[model samples]
Target: MTPNAIAEHFDTTRQAVSKHLRILTECELVTQKQQGREIYYQLEIDKMKEIDKWLEQFRKIWETRFNQLDNLLATIKNKKNE
Candidate 1:
């Protein structure tokens, strides 16, 4: 979609949408092509997959930490009841 369409959908200004689009384009997460006077932007699926993989690694780390916290909380509760 064009920046104007995205701006309208988000109820934001076209300039703001254009700035966000530029950032995404720099990250290679989104690509833009010129079609006559308008620029069309499309999502880069491979870049999205790479991001998903990176986030998944962090999710596992957080899950392990949460499990440890839960165990510590249980132990504290048991000690208080003793």
Candidate 2:
């Protein structure tokens, strides 16, 4: 979407949206195309997928840790009841 279009969904200024778009464009997360007077931005799906894949590892680790904590708490509760 164009910067103005994206800005319309948010309460921020058009310049803030443009600034964020610029950062994303620089990071290769979004690509920009100039069509006449407007610059349209599109997300790089492959780059996003790469990011998701990288974050998946941490997600799994955190889930396991949370489960372990739950088990530990259950054990403590059981011991208290005993």
Q: Against the true structure, whose lDDT is highest?
A: 2
Clashing pairs in 1: none
Model 1, 10-82: lDDT tens per residue?
Answer: 9778999999999999999999999999999999999999999989989999999999999999999999999
Candidate 2 local lDDT, 1-82, one digit each (tens): 9999999999999999999999999999999999999999999999999999999999999999999999999999999999
Residue 64, candidate 1: C-alpha displacement in angstroms: 4.0
Q: Which ten residues in a row are the worst by lDDT in model 2?
A: 31-40
Shift of residue 25 alpha carbon in model 1, Å? 0.5
Model 1 bad stretches (over 4 Å): 65-82
lDDT of each: 0.96, 0.98
* Residue 20 lDDT in candidate 1: 95
Which whole-number lDDT from 0 to 100 does residue 46 have in model 2? 100
Please give the lDDT score at residue 45 for candidate 2: 100
